[model samples]
Target: NDYGKLGRAGEAIAHSLVSSSAAGRVAYVEPFAPAPGEAQLGARNDRGLLVFSGCGTPPTGQHEVARGVVQVAELNNPVLLNFGVSEVNWWLHYEFAPVCSRTVLVAYDKLAEWDMMAPRKPVLEQVRAQLLASSDTVVGLSEGSIDDVPDASYVGHGVDRHWHDPAIDSLPEPADLAAIPRPRAVYVGALSMRFDVEAVRDLADSGLDVVLVGMAPHPALVELAERHPRIHLIGERPPEQAAAYLLHSDVGIVPHTDEPFTYSMEPHKAYNYAAAGLPTVTLNTAHAPALGPFLNATRDRKEFVDGVRTALAGGRLSPDQVAQARSLSWNRVAEAILRAA
Candidate 1:
């Protein structure tokens, strides 16, 4: 599950970071029962371990000696370490602190707030405080993300160089997309709550060809796409295929909503867009400013629409900008983490 078979950002990050080096093996240590389609067993390699660490399942009593440990405190899930591994150095990332040794808490998104009627606000705050207090190092995905945590270092999201590289993967324009009108604006990623539905609607209504390439389409998103003839929904393509669309597109759009969750986000689409050498127009978020002159971060709906038009007219990012983007690879990110650990 860590090294994803599908094209998810977190999975891509895990795969790239773990697979780049030969120093350690990655294995999944799950402690939960399989949910029908889910894999029951964990995967291992020569170097490290990548485990699901599922809940409620009993340990298998198999003890493997571990050289070093990097305990990742994933934001959405609990860290269930029932693996009988021995002699491991632990490193933590993000919210939970099962065993807080050499911890690196990553603030990738603002804490979630589900409902006002049945509130979890206080609970969320307490968790954040406990994690922050226990963490040895607090890292932010963007410069703005560090504001909540004092003295936190900004280590932006890492891009998989191989998947986004045009040389390794051919960027052929799919015939279906090629038939679409000129000045194509492609958005790649999940079509979920994070997306600004209004902005996307506007883009579709603006007479420009809007192509959405991703999975898990929110109902609202599906309705919007259904309403517009110009909006093409080609759901859930593989990384290379998705990259091909981005590479062939005139511009890439990051139509994220302005919300508490988005405030701390540094979207991987920005890096992918830069890697493809396509002009990008993103909603003005905390991380957008740091991306330099390559991206146009618009403040409002008017600006978002105008930014897209402007990007279509403007040329691609300069060689220096592209080089800068390439430098933010997962290889570099993994090295930084290992050094810190």
Candidate 2:
């Protein structure tokens, strides 16, 4: 229902399904609560697509939201694609499975064991296990994730081929980004705790100007930026603006920490950077290699800085690397999901 952006993995999936020729009359449901006094329920129609924007106080309003979902299910008996992990409201919609043609759970992230979600580890794990056992089909985003869940098939995350356009290379340097010094190592995502604070510091200490192009409300990132004049936080931007920052950059960097939670994640930013023709450096997570030839994964901060230096020298992604990134289109991923169902 939120049409403003399609950057997140689940939102991208919803968009791909709606855009696919094989899909008919697809419905996208967003359960985020609106601000006080705003409309609680909103429905938008886009040709064959129907989006339901739901609003309610969660936990208290879970029943209300689930009932709304159930009503939609009863009317269409649509195939349910559950993205729920730890949310009880999403689980409540499971009762309406009998009314749907089929139910498929997309395990896009590692459950419970992830660092940020560790507080609800037991509940998340139990719920995920239950969904894996009960859903008509289960699709894991990585091979490692499949090993963690029984009977789960792998359907890795995808990128939009449109990002590979040659036009992106020609886009003028964004005015704010132009102010940053050359050989900028760009990380274009939320500056969360998942990023190694010391690793980022190492880059700044090494005299590399680090450019972070997303929300930087995370205290560590805020503190890091305050301490290092070389580090630039461009703040959150629209997709087009973010793409310009990536496209005009010298080298793309994913300085994420090596953690059990990140084992199943293949950062979509790596794909974006590669597609935009930037040579990329990332931390060596279990699934990071799948990002293809444009990426050089490292084990430690020293190796990470070395990789960035190498990427800076090597310049942008080669034609072959861009070709590999182009192959990871969301249309293909959407078809794979539908085929799995």
Candidate 3:
């Protein structure tokens, strides 16, 4: 749990920035800007009333509320920038002095200063250097890493779990679910290249409607989607929609490949899937151990598919089982963060 610093940052900001009614109710948008029709956090000081506010780019939209309202937007369209970021991306994180004034950069955790992947050094260094070069404002960020960010204030991750877990109102009709054959499975996050390969293929071959619900990692998955009707790739659904699906689903699948990122990272869906009563099926790698009760680790393809079957044979989730998941409530998350703050 590394006690997730960015999560803390987002939660802290969500609670601290907005007004009482909208504070907890507002959204947090990272790399993306708000749609004109969308209400901006810049608009009001709402703390808790409505949660349709904005948040950008979530590593996992597993947090309790407003997944769709949250996004990752950059001031500059990354595509147009040829995959590079501009000044505005750094500014949105925090407000600062004149030279660096009007800019606040918030960062996710970094592995090390030397590590190229951590946004800590590369991003902040460039920004600060540029700001210092200007001599008009002081650039700063709220962070934990000792990167060359120069002046960073450590702050709690902002997490608003207060609005999570509304009772399912209207259920999806049986016919919609009747179509989702045995081994009720659903994936709720992006289908990145980091996904398990031969394992998913095996599951597809097994005829399980591997109800995928996010972006595709590769064209091969698209081809698999065509050939294997079971590989149902439904691009990202709203958190509520995904939660409902998981409520009825037998097992949650996170057939992730063993990669450095997978090992070092915590998969947010694993928490939500489990919280939604779906047991996870992942690789028996180092990271799997931390998942505790939620995980079903497998070493190979046959085992991976078998793990799903095992969860299915174990039977549909009992009410108690689902209740077990509810224990990891976003409220619990909120409390932890507030106490931390």
Candidate 4:
């Protein structure tokens, strides 16, 4: 249940904010159950603040803006500090962060606008000025959100090294899903419209066992499953156990429909698959370039299938390549992030 998805981002903030409390300063680390809702929430007195979200590009709509702003208003907690919140998720965060604090907080931009491809600089700037005029103390990964509040220890982003090890490079496949004679490939995560559902269907019929390892897709995907037995649609699995399947698979797939966020957003599964040293075949997306050197990419169906085929036929990576992937440990990322944050 305690996956490492937000370890890097969450740890960064915790590292910064926890010690700032007075000796009597009450401290709390509220990592939510399903989605670690709210940024950092803690208080020593009646006055407190909420760090909700950052709006990127053209910034999210006005309703979203008001929603995030109102979250604190409802909780009577307004200290707002924006930290790399996706514009899409801002409203939800807005509704959530205010549960504890309402005092005006702080904002920083240096780390706020990081996705390089963002388009709403002007909008974010406007919101920044609006927020700054009202915050108490802004101390974190932004350029100039806080005027008087000196940058303090980080409160967000870092690695969970305990989960990182060369051992990930050799995760064994699960027998429950691999007992059949099928050669398997894995795709985990949302199976919504944007994923390469059609392409997966095609590959499923090509006589390879294509095992999807995420929540079930729309009803259509199931219909496709009925037609293609090779397309073994095994539902989602626990993170720890499914990781073994990732390692044993002939190849991994990130066949996205090639959208912006899907491309721009860094998919941890790719990093995890890399850690397993399983050659990954992906659709052309923004993250592909960053991870391409370590991956094989194709936008064409034939080429994609062939890439998966070649990677499988080539057998496992040499010991050195596996070691190289292992070197990019989540723990190392965690340490660097903690120091930087």
lDDT value, residue 29 of candidate 3: 37
lDDT of each: 0.61, 0.73, 0.49, 0.51
Residues 1-341 of candidate 1: C-alpha lDDT, one tens digit per residue: 23445444444445555575532433343233445453333334423435444323222222211211233322222221111111111222221244323455555554533233126566566666665675666665565556767666666666665644547436578877888887789998878657788898888788888999988988988998888888889888877667778878888898877765565566667888887777788885555554677777777887999889988888777777777777777666555544544
Could you report the Cα RMSD, in angstroms, for every candidate shown? 6.6, 3.4, 11.0, 10.2
Q: Give the TM-score of candidate 4.
A: 0.58
Q: Ranking under lDDT, best-scoring first?
A: 2, 1, 4, 3
- Candidate 2 error regions (>4 Å): 1-6, 32-40, 46-48, 57-77, 89-95, 161-166
Residue-wise C-alpha lDDT for candidate 3, range 3-64, written one tens digit per residue: 12323334434444334332233344334343555333322223432223343432322332
Better of 1 and 3 by TM-score: 1
Top model number, TM-score: 2
Model 2 agreement with the true structure over 185-302: per-residue lDDT tens digits: 9888777668787888999899989999887557988888998988988889877668888877889888877787776666677777877778888885554456756778788899
* Per-residue alpha-carbon lDDT of candidate 4 for residues 271-290, written as tens digits (9 for 90 to 100): 55665667777875433232
The runs of at least 3 residues in candidate 3 whose Cα sits more than 4 Å from the true structure, single-residue gaps closed, are 1-41, 44-166, 174-177, 284-291
Q: What is the lDDT of residue 232 in candidate 3?
A: 73
TM-score of each: 0.77, 0.86, 0.58, 0.58
lDDT (Cα, 0-100) at 23 in candidate 1? 28
lDDT, candidate 4, equals 0.51
